[model samples]
Target: MKLVLSQEQRELRAAVRAFLGAASPLPKVREGYDPEVYARLSGELGLSGLIVAEEYGGAGAGFAELAVVLEETGAALLPGPFLATTFAAIALAEVPDKELLTAIAEGRIAATLAQPSIDLIADEVAGESATVTGTLAQVLSGMEADVLVSPALTGDGVIMVAVELAGEGVTRTALETLDLTRGQARVELAGARARVLGPRTEGGVGDRLAVALAAEQLGVMRAALDAIVAYAKVRVTFGRYIGSYQGVKHKLADMHCKLEQAESIVRYAAWAADESPGELPEAAALAQAYVGRACFEVARDHLLLHGGIGYTWEHDAHLFYKRAKTDEVLLGPPRVHRARLAESLGL
Candidate 1:
C-alpha cells in the first residue's frame, strides 16, 4: 500500500538519471538511434535485462524496478529499441522461452511484439513451427529488432509465436513518424517460419504495457512541467518575469496537480503488476485513462507557455509535445482507456 519509492529505488532512479544525463542529453537524443549507446545501456548499465530472471542472466527484478527505469528513460527521451525489447521480454516471460530470454538478458538480440494492427495468419503447422504470412503496418523498433513475438490466427485457434526477423521470408521497411527517436517499420512475412510459443489467452500483457507506458507519460509530464517552470523563472515579458503572471501561475498549478495524480496512479499500477495481479487490469486502465490525456495537455501547455520559440524546431518543447501526442495514441488514445476503465468499473 506504500506508494512512495524506497531509498534503494530512489538511488536506482538517481543512477539512471545521472547516466542518461551524461550519455543521452537532448542533443544526443536528437541525433536518433545509436547502436553503441544502446549497447552500453544494455551491457554497462544492465538495463536490458533488469526485469528478466537471474537464472536467465538478468537482474531478476520486477515491474516496480522496471517502472523506475522507464520513468527516467522517458524523462531523458532515450532512443533506440529499449522499450520494444522490454515488451518482447515480457511476452517471452509469459511463455518462458529460456534461450530467448537469455539472449535478451545478454543483449545478444533485440525484439518487439507485433501489435494487433498486424494481423498475421498461420494456415499450417507442422510439429513445433508454423508458416506465417502477413504485413505488420507499423512496428515499434521493427527496423532494429532481431525477433518478433506475435499472436497469429490459425486453424486451431489464435496462437502465440516467435519469428526471426533476419530470416529469408521477412522484409522490413522504415517509416516516418512524429516521434523520431522511437522508429517504426513495416514488416512483411511471406510464409516465414515461426516457432510456436504457446496458446493465446487473456494474459495481461496489454495491461502491463499500458502501465509501463503510463509511467513514461508521467515522466514526460514531469519533464515538461519542470522545463516550462524553469523558463518562466528566467524569461521576462513586459518588464516582469513570466512566472509573475496570474494566468501562467494558474496553468502551472493545474499541470502540477495532473502530474501528481498521474504519478500516484502510475505507481499503484506498477505495484499491482508486481504484487497484485488481480488488480492489474483495473489499475492499468485507470493509469492510461488519466495519464495519457494529462501528459498531452501538460506537454501542449508546456509548449504554449514558452510562446513562439516553442514552435521552432530548435527548441526542445516540440520534442516533448510530439512524444506526448504520439504516446497518447500509441496503444489507442485516452478515450479507449477511458472506456476500458468504465468497463472494468462495471459502469
Candidate 2:
C-alpha cells in the first residue's frame, strides 16, 4: 500500500499548519485554552470531526486526514480538549451514536475516555444501561468533558459505557499534571448510570490510540528538530556558528534519522488504522515503541541545544520537552509498547 500522503492530504496539512501557526502560536498555547479559537477550529476548520461520518454532521474524512490535523496540532501545541475529544469521538465511532457524534462534531460537548482507572460496580441491564462506580485519577481533559467513554470490567466480559459527567453521582476534580497545555482530572463516580456502548476489545482501542499518539509524537519530533537545526545555523559561539561544529552536526543528523524513522512508522500505522485492520496491532505497537522514545530524545536535545535558555521558563524549548516527557508516559511508556510488540510477534 502507498504510505505517502496524497497531494490533497499535503494541502490539508499545509492548511492546518498555517491556521495553527497564526491562531495557536506558542505564546497563545502558553496562555492556555481559548474558547473562541477552539470554536473556529471545530466549526470553521471542521477538525473535531475529521474522522466522523458526514451523516453524523462531520466531514466524513478518514484517519489519514485526522492524523494530518493531529500533526499540526502537536507542532503548535494547541490547547483545549481537541485530542481528548477527538479520541473520544474515535472510540464512539465504533459504537456510532448519531446525536452524540453530532454534538461532538458541532463542538458543543467535550468528551474523554476513562481508562486505566474506571471500574464496574454493577450491571443492572435495565434497557441498555448499567450502574458504574470508579475513580479515574488521571483523566485527560476530564474536568472539561461533558461525557466519558468508559470501559468497565464485567462478569461476562468487559463492557464499554457512555457516562454523563454532569449527571448525578459523578464528581470531577482537576489534578496537577506535567503538561500544562493538557489538563487532567480525577473523576469519582458513585453508582452513576451509564449508557452501554458495546463489548470492550483487547487491542482495537489501544492500537488506534497508539497510532494517533504516534502521529502527534511525530509532529513533536519534527518541530523540535526543525527548531534546533534553525537555531544551530545562526547561533555563534567563540565567533563560530554552532551548526559548523562536527559534534552538533552529528547530533542533528541523528535526530533527523530518528525523525524520518518515526515519520515512516507513524504514516504506515495511520494508513493501517484506516485501511488494514489486520496489520494495525503490529504497526501501532511499532509506531508507539519507536516514536515515543525518539520524540522524547529529540525534544530533550532541543532543550540541550538551546543551552541555558532552554531551561528558563521563557523559552519555548521547555514546552516541547515537557510535552514529549508527558507523552512518553501518557500511554504507559515506550517499554509497554515494546513489550506489546514482542508479544504480538511471539517473541
Candidate 3:
C-alpha cells in the first residue's frame, strides 16, 4: 500500500528520462516512427537484455524494472517492439532454448506478438510444433522482428508458438497506421515454421500476454497524465492559466487520482507477474480495466485542454490521444478487460 517509489526506482525513472532527452529528443521522435530508431536505442540503452536473466545475456532485472523502464519509454512515445519484445522475453525466460534467449538479449534477435486469433484458447498449451496460417496485420514493429509469438491449435487446445520471422513461406510487409508515430507491419503466415515455447496447459500464455499488455497500459496512463498536467499550467485562457480555473483543476485532479489508483494496480500486477505468476490473469485484468479507460480519458482531457488547437496536427496531445486509443485495443478493449475481471471474480 506504499505510494512512494524506492530510491532506486526514482533514480531509474530519472536516468531513463535523461537518456531519452539527450539520445532521442522529441524532435527526433517526431521525425519518424521508425522502429529502427528504438531498436538501436534498445541496444544503446541495454534494454534488449531488460527481462532476460543473468544466465541468458541480460542484466537480470525483474518486471519491476520492466515497469519502470517502460513507463519512461511510454512517456517519450518511443515507437518500437519494446512492450511486445519484453513480453516475449517473459516467455523466453522460461525457454530451455538458451540460444534464442541469448539472441534477443544480445540484440541480434527481435520478437513481437500479434493479437491472438479467434481460435486462440486461453488454456491448454503443450506439445510439438503446430500449424498456423493466415496473417496478423498492424503488428507493432512486426517487420523488424526476427520472431513472432502466435497462438496455434495443438490438438484440442490452442497455445503460444515462437515462429521465426524468416521462416519459409512467411511474408512481411510494412504498414501505415492511424498513429503514424508508431510502426506497424503485416505478417503473412503460410506454412510458417514454429517452436512451442509455452502452452496454456502448462502456463497460459494468453493470460500472460494480457498481463504484459496491462503493464504497458499503466505506462501509457502515466504519460498521458503527465502530459495533461504539464499542458494545464502553460496553456492560457481568460487572461490566466487554465489550470487555475476551478473546473479544469477539478478535472485534472480527478485524472491524477485515477492515475494513482491505476499506478497502484500496475505495481501490484507487475509484482504478481514477476514474483507470483499464478495470480496474473485476475491481477492483469484488474489493472487493465482501471488503466485502459483512465488513460483514454486523461488523454482526451489533455486534447481538450489545448482548445481548438488540440485538434490540429501540430500538437503532441493528439498523438498521445491516438496512441492511447490504439493501445486500448492492443490486447482487447476495456469491456474485454471488465468481462475478464467479472469472470475472474466468478460473478
Compare the candidates by TM-score and give the number of the best one: 1
TM-scores for all candidates: the values are 0.98, 0.96, 0.87
Total backbone clashes of candidate 1, pairs 3 or more residues apart or in separate chains = 0
Error of 1 at 17 (Å): 0.6
Off by over 4 Å in 2: 116-118
Candidate 2 local lDDT, 26-123, one digit each (tens): 98898887878888888878888788799999999977888888888998887778888888887887787787899889888888876644455546
Question: Least accurate stretch of 10 residues (summed lDDT) in model 2?
Answer: 114-123
Q: Judge candidate 2 against the unseen true structure and give its global Cα lDDT, from 0 to 1.
A: 0.86
Write the residue-wise lDDT of candidate 3 on 81-131 in tens digits: 666677677765544457777887887777886665633322223255655
Better of 1 and 3 by lDDT: 1
lDDT (CA) per prediction: 0.90, 0.86, 0.73
Q: For each candidate, how many residue pairs have backbone atoms clashing (under 3 Å)?
A: 0, 0, 4
Note the residue pairs that clash in candidate 1.
Answer: none
Give model 1's TM-score versus the native structure: 0.98
RMSD of each: 1.1, 1.5, 3.5
